[model samples]
Target: MADIARRPFLRHLRAETTSYVQHLRNGEVRHAGAGIAFWFRPATAALAEVPLDDREQTLLFHARTADFQDVTVQATVSVRAVEPALAATRIDFGIDPRTGRWRAAPLEVLGGLLTELAQQPALDLLATLGMAEALARGLAPVRDRIAEALAADPRLAERGLAVTDVRVVAIRTDPEVERALQTETRERVQQEADRATYERRAVAVERERAIAENELANQIELARR
Candidate 1:
């Protein structure tokens, strides 16, 4: 059984876990798996592990819109780790810098990175649109743009982090700006209503004038006859 003794040990990886098997010989990634596995020598081997299951996350940050207005952006995101080893590189994994002991959780590290990534695109998109227009247009385009931007980023792909969906929970501006937009919208609606009423009144006046002229002409014809 000397041949069997020399072989690497078997590591069990569940379906919901992402795994990265590395070879210590040359410091190269020996294998990467999502719901999969690979064999490696244990003495010189270093393995980094992360969860592959779905995760829900959130972001609460402030960013300025195109109109130079400060706004608070709240967003919700769903993410899954596709490359646990790559993601592990980006995350500290709660390792103590001094002693190299574990302290923090993986989710925490992922959350911080996700928060930064999620906010950058959102802020960028918001900066291109005016604050009032952002509120008026709603969050559909904002969500789409953020998702697309995240998909295009090479770093996220390298880390094997997949952003499933991003949603803008709320975008809040200064109270004064909100009131100003409301007042402007109210005034515009009122003006349109007033214009419609004036048009209807003008049409009624013209109809009445026409009816009165017809009545007068009929009266004159009767008198002549």
Candidate 2:
């Protein structure tokens, strides 16, 4: 919704339900709250808007495993601003009263911070595991590690941000490496199958030999009788 209406020299501003707005005049806060409506002089008013709704950020990055193999990590992180006042102070959420648009990209700055925090723990964990181990068991452990780091980081709390959830979707190696592993597995399976077939044929030949010997013994006894 268009929250700003212009009439004469005064601009009426109404904040969105998901947004928390802070209005300041003469270096003092005049109004501060969510979904607030007020009128102010554009030249004398300073405005800041912080989003209170939860947002999900997708992250994709590469890391090296213990075996010196490179792998890609895909993850999603859910976050929200808890304190509008603190968040505004930490980042440039200031907007022009006349245009009602932010003077800076605050969300991009937050996303960059989150990406750095999430990547650190994940990279540390992957560096300790081999490629196969990372692919097999790295997802949950990486997710937990990132979650713990984000939750415990003082910077996030100071900025009035909270990490609601962390999910690691996949840990994958290079395509050529994956294909090589698959080929090795397929060869092992084929060898086992061949061995089983040989054993079954040997058992059938032994049974036939025993049956022929029993028939020859019976014929000899009948001739003697």
Candidate 3:
């Protein structure tokens, strides 16, 4: 009887709780999410998983407005590795394939890229809007623009990075700039109030003069009659 060659057995694979996986076998690589059983030669298969869930981080950036006033922007950036192969090649995944042992994790690479992409667009937008408009509109509008700019970037896609969410947490003026704005607002309000008071007093004086003239007319009529 001839000996028969045994085929590679099927095995179950589960993605990490918050991660995704690239299953590579026999010169083919497949991206997978969740658990699915598949057949692969144990010796030839490579399974790499990186976090799929977005990682949240805060970054503070400084940009000068068109008026040459400096402003501080605080933002929350949510990023994730979307392409398994690019991520594996670009970032140091801590686990050593042979040892499967703990290694000091590498710094976040995707986050840095996302920050770079977001910062310039934000600054450019601020330049167009100027300081007053930026402060007046607040972060909501800017957040949307930043997020859109990041999403539409082809470079990010090439690097296998994605910005899931970006929040303009706050945009702060320099302390001196803030005080100046506040003082200007206060003075304008005061001026408006003073104008109102003056107008009220003028109206009162006119009413009083009208009443006196009527009284005089009545007195003169009474005497003439």
Candidate 4:
């Protein structure tokens, strides 16, 4: 029998396109996908593939407002890879073939941190603290926990993925709470105005009484003379 050539099945695969990869000065990473893109501040067309070991890390966080019920927010986090040379061997962020989106193992670690933040008291989280600063403080404990988790992962340890920063983006506040605050402010202002009016009237009355007494004393002195 003559040798026959067998045809191989060809599967259609789509080529991936890269878009909106930002390397911020604060050692943060931002990869914007299809719906949105980042205009890299202070730089243009500087998008480059983060070496496997040096690729940025990303995390998703969810938080709820205590003052306002049913209010929740989602944040996307990205961190720069500490060791560029060992990135490929240490961290395996599976990039989506079609979207060129990068996914890191520490994402779960981020989730755990977010979980802790969500469980915290809402009043304390929002008290006198800027939303972003409060969130950063809340995530500090998680950052330590993430360091420990990454250290345990042999692959992660090789590339030194440091948790440099935790940012809280797209924070949401409750409409009802905002309205209440406004109302309270207006009431306070009105009260202050009313108090000022009473004080001015009292001063005028005292001045008028002093003038009348002076006139009476002048007439008595004239009569005595």
Q: What are the RMSDs of all candidates, in order?
A: 7.1, 3.3, 7.5, 13.7
- In Å, residue 149's CA in model 4 sits off its true spot by 15
What does candidate 1's lDDT look like per residue over 1-225, in tens digits?
001123335333222233332223357666555444444444554544455667888878888888898988878888887766667777644232222234457676667877877778888889898988888784887788778877888767887789887888888888998999999999999999999999999999999999999999999999999
Report the lDDT tens digits of candidate 3 across residue range 1-225: 011123545344544456555567665775354333344444566655566667887877888878887888899988777785577556665343333322345334555766788898888888877788778785887798789988899987786778878889899997888888989989999999999999999999999999999999999999999
- List TM-scores for all candidates, in order: 0.70, 0.83, 0.68, 0.42
Worst 10 residues of 1 by lDDT: 1-10
User: Best by lDDT, which number?
Assistant: 2
Error of 4 at 199 (Å): 1.3
In candidate 4, stretches whose alpha carbon ends up further than 4 angstroms from where it belongs are: 1-78, 85-91, 94-159, 162-172
- Residue 154 accuracy (lDDT) in model 1: 79
The lDDT for every candidate, in the order shown, is 0.69, 0.90, 0.70, 0.43
Residue 144 accuracy (lDDT) in model 1: 85
lDDT of 2 by residue, 83-123 (tens): 88999889888988878899888888888899999898999
Q: Sorted by TM-score, highest first, which candidate order results?
A: 2, 1, 3, 4
Candidate 1 residues lying further than 4 Å off, grouped into runs, are 1-49, 85-102
Q: What lDDT is reached at residue 149 by model 1?
A: 79
Model 2 superposed RMSD (Cα): 3.3
**Stronger candidate by lDDT (2 vs 4):** 2
Candidate number that wins on TM-score, 1 or 2: 2
